[model samples]
Target: MDFKVQLLQRKSKIDKVIGEVFKDKNGLQKTVIEAMEYSIKAGGKRLRPVLLLEVCNILDGDIDYAMPFALAMEMIHTYSLIHDDLPAMDNDDYRRGKLTNHKVYGEGIAILAGDGLLNLAFETMLDSINNDPKLCNRGIKAMQIISKASGINGMIGGQVVDLEWEGKKIDIETLDFIHKHKTSALIEASINAGAILGGAEENQYLELQNYGRCIGLAFQIVDDILDEIGDEEKLGKKVGSDKSNEKSTYPSLYGIEKSKEIVSGLIENSLKSLEIFKEKAEFLRSLAKYLEVRDH
Candidate 1:
């Protein structure tokens, strides 16, 4: 199958699993649950989880066995977006072309909804262990990678730096740190987790880690470009707010043309890192190109 077809099929499968997980279960915490459902189910590419599953599938790993972890990755990504859109953060009112969770459910419930998703992400990771006892060790390793990525040293650390440096003319090192932590950390984790769950050997796993790092950085740089020149309708979220928030972006640090150069270079490096995979990594190579050029 072509990469696009395979990508579309995998995305649909991830969406189905996510939908099932958030479906009504007769729980009493209806408000938060609704908020969770709204945020996670909001239409988008569902990129992170698909990336996880793709790495697994490319390694000849069972997609079904990797499904739970893939779903957990998406849940965590959604939770991060929900929190990032809060008034205290980016303060966006819309996401994926719909009202943000806080906008519809109030700030309090939105906060809880993010918290719920984050916590439930861990539970879901554990569920993969229960699904197959032999996978228990891999699940634990995946969880640790994900936890570190989402924690103070990774995403949160980047976020803190972002907050502190907002409106300031930051140096290149600071800017790189912010991007690597804020965006790239979770992306890298998704790739690593897939490798682990897919039973990758040490060298393949290390190569994927390098591949993830390059793409993660490239992905955020594209996001920076999108914020500058992307169509609002296509982007499914407001743009120009990066400037409004006084945030430093790739385009801000380096002009738009230079930012594009940087992205192209990173994608090149990413593809090079995967050369060891030879023909087995074509999907990943194509995906990196897609991320570099993606509008959203």
Candidate 2:
């Protein structure tokens, strides 16, 4: 299948799984459920889940075995976005061309909704393990990787630093620290979870880790560039919010031309990491290039 066709097929599967996971339950709090569903259902590229499924395929792992982890990663990703858009954080009022969770549902309910998604993500993964006892170990490891990536050492930590460093002049090393933890952590976890669940060998696992790190940073660089050059209609959110908020970004630190250069370099390194996997990693390679060049 062509790349776009393959992406669409995987996206359809992910959408179905997400819908089933969020199906109605008796006595559920409608407001919180609505808030959670609003953000999850809001259209994005579904990149994290796609990465998981793709990595699993590359490793010759059963895609079915990786589905729950893909869903879990997305839930965690959505939760992060919910919190990131809150009044205390990015303070955004829109996401994916609609009202943010807090804007539509009120701050308190939105916070609860984010918390609920985080807890429920674990529940969903555990249920997946229970259904297939033999996958218990793989599920457990994947969970550990995800938990760390989403916790203080990863996304949360990055958020903390980002908040602290706003409007402050920072050096390249500090900026890298913030981006690696804030943006790259969950991405790294997504790819690593897929590899672990797929039972990739130790060497392959290390190579995938390197691949993920490069692409993860590149992803953010491209995002920074888009914020500068992209249309709101295309991006589906307020562009240049980083500049408006005075948040430090690669483009802010380095000029736009230089930022693009950095992204290209990162993409090159990411592709190089797949040299061992060669043709088996073509999808992953294409994905890295896509991330660097995609408009949104």
Candidate 3:
């Protein structure tokens, strides 16, 4: 199948899972659930969950068992976006060509919605484990990877640096730290957790982890490039916020041409890391290539 076709299929599956997550909305907190549904249903690439499932598929793991983890990964990612777009954070007005969470649901509800997603992500993972205690060990391990990645030393830590360094002259090391922690951490977790649940060998696990790190960094670099020169209509969000916010980015540090070169290098490394998987990794290889040229 074509890469985009495969991508759309996976996205559709992910969307289905998300849709079912809040279908039975009958409680006092229904509004919060609705808000949560609003953000998660807002269309995007669903890259994190797609990566998680693909990793499992390539390793011949049980997709049914991995489904909860994939959903959890997406929930955490969406929660971050909801908070990221708040008045106190990125202060954005749009996402995925629609109003941001706060814009439609009000800031208070949006805040609760983000919090609800974060908590429900854990519940979803734990529920899976509860339903199948035999897989408890694997489930716990995957959850641990995700927890650390989204925790204080990972995504949140990176966000702190990103917020603090806005409008400040930051060095390459600081910029790298922010990217690795804030963005790359969760991406790495998606792959690492999938590898664990997929029963990968130590070598395969390490290689996939490295691949995740490379592509994750490259993904952010592409975002940086797009922020500078991308079409806002295609992006579904305002462009040039990086400059307006004075955020430190690969493009800001190295110029657009140089940043593109860097993204190419990272994508190259990511593909190389999957060489051991050979033909089975063809989809992943194509994905890395796609990231290099994706407009949004």
lDDT of 2 by residue, 1-296 (tens): 68778778889989999998767855647778878988999987889999988988888988887898899889989999999989898888888898999988999999998999999889888888899999889889998999999999999999899888888888888889888998899899999999998999999999999999999999988888899888889888878888887877889889899999999998999998899998989888888988987987
Best by TM-score: 3
Cα lDDT tens digits, model 3, 178-197, are 99998999999999999988
What's the lDDT for residue 281 in model 3?
A: 94
Question: What do the candidate models score in CA lDDT, each in turn?
Answer: 0.88, 0.89, 0.92
Writing each residue's lDDT as its tens digit, candidate 1 over 1-296 gives 88779779878887888888867857688878888999998987877898898888778887787888888888888888898889998788988899999999999999999999999998887877887887788888888998999999999899889878878888899999999999999899999999988899999999899999999999999999999899998998778878877778889888999999989998998998899888988889989998987877
Candidate number achieving the greatest lDDT relative to the actual structure: 3
In each prediction, how many residue pairs overlap at the backbone (N, C-alpha, C within less than 3 A)?
A: 0, 0, 0
Ranking by TM-score: 3, 2, 1
Candidate 1, overall lDDT?
A: 0.88
lDDT score at residue 108, model 1, on the 0-100 scale: 94
Two-way lDDT contest, 1 vs 2, winner: 2
* lDDT: worst 10-residue window of model 3: 241-250
Spell out the clash pairs found in candidate 2: none
